[model samples]
Target: MTLIYQAGQAQQTGQIVPQLFVSIQQPSQVALNGVSTQRIGIVGTASWGPVNTPVGLSDIAGYRSSFGEKQDGDADMGVAVSVAQLQGANDFRCVRVTDGTDVAATGTLSGVTFTAVYTGTTGNALTVSLSQIGTSSNWQLTTSHAVLGSRAYSGANWSSLQAEVSADGSAFIAVTLPAVAPALATGTVTLSGGTNGGAQTSVQFVGSDDSDARTGMYALRNQGCAIGFIHGLTDTTLAGVIGTFGMSEGIYMIASGPSGDTISNAIALSASVGYKSYGLKMMFGDWLYYDDDTLDTVLISPQSFVAGRLATLAPSESSLNKQIAGIDGSQKAGLVSTGSSKTYSSAELTELFTAGIDVVCNPVPGGSYWAVRGGYNTSLNTQTWGDEYTRLTNYIAESLAGGMGAYIGEPINGTLFGDVRASILGLLSDMRGAGYLDNTGTTVPYTVVCDTSNNPQSRTAIGYLQADVQVEYMGINRFFNINLQGGAGVSVTVSNG
Candidate 1:
C-alpha cells in the first residue's frame, strides 16, 4: 500500500520548505498491529437460542440476548460467561446447540392451535390467552412470552387453524376457546407430549453439518478469531475435535477437566491428539463460587478464565498467578480442591504443571480471584512450550507473514531474501526491547535462519518460503536455594547456592 500527497501550494522560488503542515508518516518500527491473542469462543447448549452458530457478544446482556436469557438447564454457561466478563474479557463468541427433536408447547382456539416458536424448555412457561377481540367469533390469542405474540382469528371451531402454526409458548397455561358464537370464556391449557429428546453428546458438539448451520464446533469455522476456550466439552471429545477437526489460523483451544476427570486422563487426551501441534491447553479443576444465596460446591470450568486472563494481559506477560475476577473475593470460593477429597500435594502440582494442565492456588495477598497456574502448555514434554512463548512465536510468524507480503510472487532474489531477513531481525530487536526476547546486547535469544544455504534454487522453485524461528521464552523458577554463612563475630551472611 502506497500513499501520495498533493497538498502543498506552489511556493515562490525555493521558499522555506514548510514542514508541509502535515503528519509525517514514518515507517513504523514498532509493529503497528500484532496477531490478536484475545478473541475467545465457547460451544454449548443454551436454555434458548439458535443452534451451532458463532455469536460474538459484548457482555452478559448481549450473551443472554443471543442465547436466550440464562435460566434453568443453562448448565455452567452462565457462570462461565459471568466469570469471563469479570476477567475483563469483552470480546467473546458463543455456540448454542440443542436437540433437534425437542418440541414446544401449543395453544388452541376455534380449531386454530399456535405452537411454541422454538424448541426449548424455556417455552414451557408461556401463557397464551384466547379472548374475543370485540363481540364476535373473531378471537385474539395473546402469548405472555415474546417468543410468541398475539394472533387474531375468526373461526367457529378450535381446530379451524388446522395448519399448525408454531407461534410460541411458556409454562403458563393456555386459555381454551369458548364454544359460543360470541362470548368470552378462558381456560388454562397445557400442551402435552413435549419432550426435549436428550443432552448433546460429544459427537453432536462437533457438528460438521453446516447445511442448516448447526454443526456444534463446525459452526465456528472461518469464525475469524482464535478460539481461546472450548468451554465445557470433555477431554476425550476435545481431543477428537482437535485430532479430527483442526483449529486453523494458529488458534489454541483451552480445555477443562471436570470433577471426575483425572490428570492422567487429561494428559492422555493431550497426547492422543498430538496436542502440541493443536495448541490445546487443559485446565484441570480450577475453583469458582457457585451459589450467591448460600454457599454450594460446583465444578466450574476454568478455560474461560484462562482465555480471559491471557486476553487481558500484555503479550509479553504471563497470565499465571492472576486472580480470577469474581471469585477472588467470594468467600465461597477456595483453591485446589478436587471431587476426590484429595488436595494436589506440592509435588503433584509440579507434575501436573509439566503435563500441560493449569492449576489454581489460594489468593495472592491482595488479589481476589484464585491464582492461575501459568495458563498455557503443549504436551507432557514440559520444556517445550509456554503460553507467552508460543504466543510470541505465533505473533512473529503472523507479523512476518504480513510484513513479507510484498515479496509473495516476486522473483526469488537476493534483495527479497535480505528484506525478509531484515524484517525478521527488526521484529526480533523490538521483541528484545519488550522483554519477549532475552538478548543482552550480546547473546541473541532467538535465531532466524533464512539464508541461501537453506533456501537454494530447488526449494525456491517449488514456491515455498520458510523461516526457522527459535525462541527461548523464560520459564518459572520453581526451585531456588540460598546458603547462610556464620562468622565467629556472630555475623551471618547469605550467599547464593
Candidate 2:
C-alpha cells in the first residue's frame, strides 16, 4: 500500500473513479488466544536426521519420515512418542539428534562431481546417477541415501550437478558450465566413508545453544499449541535447565525423577524440595510398570504418558486421579523384580506423594492409575505443586498475551484499549463458565484492569502500555472427611432389625 504520485488536476470523472474506491474502518474481531493445554512437545535422540530442528509428528509414520526408524537402544524418542500418541497426546514436535558425518555418493562428469547432501554412516549405501541427454550437455541427475531415497533433478548444467540441500532432502543444485562440454555417461554410483557420531548427552537434549533457531524446550515457546515438552532423558543437568527455562518462558516440562534416589531424596528434600529445584513449571515422574517382554521393571519415564493424559483432559482438570495409559497396577501381579519388588502399601505411598513423588498405584488389583502427587512447589497456601494451578494460570495469562500481541503497534486510543480490555474480560468469563477459572462462592475468579489511569499520554508517547491482571487459581479437594456422632442426640436405632 505505497502512497504514490502527486496531486493531479481533475482530468476526468472516469479516470479518477478507478482510484475512488471507498475504504471502510469498522469493528473487527481480536479474539483472545487460548493456550493449548492438550499438546505435547519433545526432543530426543534418533537413528539419523538433522540435529536440533523441530519436526511436527503425529504418528509412527511421521516419525519414520522426519527421523529414520529406530534401531536397538536408539529407541528413546520412538518409544516415548508411541506411548504419548497412543495415549491421546494432541501432537509431538521432535528434534532428532544424529550427530555424525554425512556419508556421500559421488560421480564425476567432465571433471565435475556430485556429492551426498548429509554426512552419515547411513549415507554410505547411497546411489546416484546422471544421464546426459543424448550428445547434449543437458543432463538429469538423481541422488539418494541408503536410508533416504533418491532426489531427482532435470537441467542443463554444463559443469557439475549436485544434491540440493535442505532441512528435508528434496531438490538438487548444479553449477553453470561452458557452452562446449564433454559428453557424460550414465551409471549408478554408490557412496561411502561417512560416520555416525556418538550417543547424545543430557546437555544435547535440553540444550542452551544460542544460535539454534529454537533451542531445546524453547522450541515449544512460540509454537503456542504445546503446553510443554517431556525431556524424556531425566539427566539432572537437563532437568535443572528445563526447570529454569520453562517458568521463564511460560512453557511446562514433564521429567523423570532421579531413578534410584527419588525415594530417599524426595523424603529428605521435603518442604525445601521445590526450593532446591525452583519447581515452578516442572512435574517429576515416578515408577510406572514392568515390561514383561524384557522381563524387567521398565525404566522408560512416565513423562510422556502423564503429558498425554493431561492433554486429553480439560485444562482445569487435575492430573490427579487420572488413569495413566499402559501402567499395570498390581501388588504381586507376578511382575519380575529388578531390585526390591515395586510393591508398597497405601500409607507408604501417601508419604511418598506428600513428600513429592508421583507414585503409580493400583487401588484395585488390575487397575493402575497415577497418583499425580509429586511436584516442586513452595507455596503451602495452595496446591501449586499439583501442576494444575500453574497450568491454569499459565494458560490464562499466555492466552491473553497471545491475543493482545496483535494490537501492540496499533494507534493508542480509548477505543483500542477498551477493546483489548473487553477481550480479556470476555475470555476470563468464558474460562469461569468452562470451570477453568475459580468462580466458587469463596473466591474472585479474575480481574482485568486497563484504562487511562494506567496508560497516560507520557507513557503512550514512549510506546508503553500496561495492564494489571489478578487471577485466583482454583483448588482441588484432594482430601475428604466423614464422621458420625451418636452421643449428642443420645438416640440410636438398630436398622438391621
Candidate 3:
C-alpha cells in the first residue's frame, strides 16, 4: 500500500515503498462580504448589567431587558438607545460603566436567599413569594418586578425549585436554596439595599485599552462597530482619546458640546482640544429636545441622533440633508423652555463650520427640515471633511483587511500576486457597482497593483509581498448655484436641429 503525506509534511527523498504526497492550496479568487456600517457602539452608565463588557442589542426592548429602564439623566445607556432608535438604528454594542460602589439587592425567605443578578437600584424592585400549589405537597415560587413582570415555577422540593427557575433563563434575580429543605410557607419579601453607585467620570467612559482586560470604549474593539458615542458626555478634553480610538478601529465617533452653548465657546473648546481627525465628528451645542415616555420632554445631547442618522445611511451617503426623526425641537430652534427660538446667523454658522463643528438646524440646503447643517468631520483638510469620505474609506479598508487574510501562509509566487490582485479588484468592482466609488471623469474609479512591478526581488527574496490600492470616493453636493438672466435685458438664441 502507498503512504500518503499531507501538505508541508516531510518525506524521504529515496523510499523503497511507494509514497504519495498532496499539497493543498487556497483558491486564487476570494469572495468578500462588505462589513456592516450600521452597528453603533454606546458607552455610558447604566442602572444594571455587566460593567465594561460589550453587549449586543437589537432594539430598545432588548436594551431595557439587559440594562434596565432609562434613568433621570443623560448618562443612561437606555436613554441613548431610545434616542438612537428613532433614526432607525437597531444594531448596537453597548458597554456599561460604574463608579465602583454598586450593590446587589437581596432578600431571604425562610431558609432560602434570593439576590438580584445585577447591582443597581432597579434590582430593589424585585419581590419573591412562595406558596403551596393546590393542596399538593409541591410548592410554587413566584418572582415579580415592575418591569420584568412575573414568573412562576413549581417543584416538589427546594433543589428542584432552584433548578426550574435557573433553567428558565431568569433575567432579574438569582435563587439560592438551603442545604436542607425547610417547611414551606406563604409569604412575599421585597429586595432592598441595591445601589447604582456614583456617576461615572469621563475617564471611566473612555476606559482602558488593555487587551486581556478591556474596559469601557475599548471593550468594543474588534466588535464590528462602525459608529460610536458616549451618551451625554460633553467634555472636550477627551476628544483626542476617542478620536484616536476611532481612527485606529475604523469607527466614526460622534461627540457634542454642552446644551445651549454659545458658538464662540464651541469654537474655543475645539481649538483647545486641537484634534483634527477624519474619524470624529464634533457637534455644536444645539441639544435636541425629545419627548420620552417616562421623562416627558427632555433635552439630550445631539451625539446619539447624529450617530444614528449616520448609521442608517449607506457608507457613500451623507447626513447633511437627511431629516432627523423623533425630534420635538432643539435648543436653537422651535419651542425652547427658557426662551424663544433663536436662529443662527450666517456669520455664526460660518464660524462653527470653519472650526470643524456641525449643528442640527432647520432650513437645510434642501428645505425647511431639521438636518445636519454641514456634512463634515473634525478634519481640517477639506479633502476628508465630508462624512462619506470617512465612512467609505473605513468600509473599504476593513473589508479588504478582513478578506485578504486568506492569502497568508501560501506560496509566495506569481500565483500569490495574481490572487492578491484578483481579490482586491473584485472588492473594488463590487464597491463601484454599489455606488461607493465613482468618477465623473473618463478615468476608472480605482486601481490595484500587486504584481512584480511593485514587489521587487529585493523584497520578495526576504518573504515580503505587497499590494497597493487606491480608490476614488464619491463626493457630496455641498454647494449649488444657479445663474439667471432677465427676460427683458437678455437676448435668447434659438437652436434648430
TM-scores of the candidates are 0.67, 0.72, 0.91
Candidate 3: RMSD to truth: 3.3
By summed lDDT, the worst window of 10 consecutive residues in model 2 runs over: 165-174
Residue 206 accuracy (lDDT) in model 2: 64
Q: Rank the candidates by TM-score, best first.
A: 3, 2, 1
What does candidate 3's lDDT look like per residue over 1-497, in tens digits? 54455544654466566556555544567788899999999999887888899999998899877888788888788878888898999999999988888999999999789999889988888899999988999999898887767889898878888888888865467888778877778889999999999878888888899999999889989999999988888888888888899989999999889878998898888899986989899999889888888778888998888888998899999999899887778877855446555677889889998999999987677786678989889998999998998898889888988988887787788888888888888888887777777735677888899888999999988888899998877778888778977878788999998
lDDT of 1 by residue, 253-365 (tens): 66666655565776666565555533566667544444422124444566666777777775556666666654432222333343222335677666677666776545433
RMSD of each: 8.6, 7.3, 3.3
lDDT leaderboard ranking: 3, 2, 1
> Each prediction's Cα lDDT score?
0.58, 0.58, 0.86
- The alpha-carbon lDDT assigned to residue 18 of candidate 3 equals 59
Better of 1 and 3 by lDDT: 3
